[model samples]
Target: SQQGEEDPQALSIQEGENATMNCSYKTSINNLQWYRQNSGRGLVHLILIRSNEREKHSGRLRVTLDTSKKSSSLLITASRAADTASYFCATDFKETSGSRLTFGEGTQLTVNP
Candidate 1:
């Protein structure tokens, strides 16, 4: 079953502009991870923010988690055309269910050059 739901089904932006994506989840999570996919192919791990972590950053990506609200947000700074891709939030609830990862529908981001 899907656990995460991303806000704003799609986004379009010009190169150099920042892009922000939000995700909401239904239940408690151990860790929330972000990934980037190109052309609907393999996903590249962007970052993973644990339930104990309120925020984390990697390179140009910044992620914030609010367990109280059961939500998370990702921000990409200095967006480029190469950054155009689908972003997904995934969570593993091994504490409740067996080891299985549930993913969000994803947010398709378009960065125009």
Candidate 2:
């Protein structure tokens, strides 16, 4: 079963702007991580914020989590054309599920040059 999925399949942005996306899950989880994949680049880990945490920030990226709602949000500040890529959210399930980062379909982001 799909554990986590991001909202809005795609997003287009200007050279210098902020973009936000949300992710929702189906069951209780151990932790959730966000990743970014360029058009032809490997998916790189962006952040990993646990269920117990509410929010986290790294550089221009801000992430928020709401365990009660089984949801999370990612905010990218000062967008650039290089930021154009697909973003995905993944989660580590409970003990019985094993340690696997199940990723979502992803949200395609376009930053116009």
Superposing all C-alpha atoms, what RMSD in Å does each candidate have to the true structure? 1.4, 1.2
Number of clashing pairs per prediction, in order: 0, 0
Tell me how far the alpha carbon of residue 61 in candidate 1 is from the true structure, in angstroms, after superposition: 0.1
* Number of residue pairs clashing in candidate 1, backbone atoms closer than 3 angstroms, sequence gap of 3 or more or interchain: 0
Candidate 2 lDDT, 1-113, residue by residue in tens? 85688988999989889999999998888899999998778999999999889999999999999999999999999998888999999988766656777899999999997
lDDT of 1 by residue, 1-113 (tens): 54899988899999999999999998888899999999948999899999999989999999999999999999999999999999999986676456766899999999999
lDDT of 2 at 101: 78
How close to the true structure is residue 51 of candidate 1, measured as C-alpha lDDT? 94
Instruction: State which candidate has the highest lDDT.
Output: 1
Q: After superposition, how far is residue 9 of candidate 2 from its true place, in Å?
A: 0.3
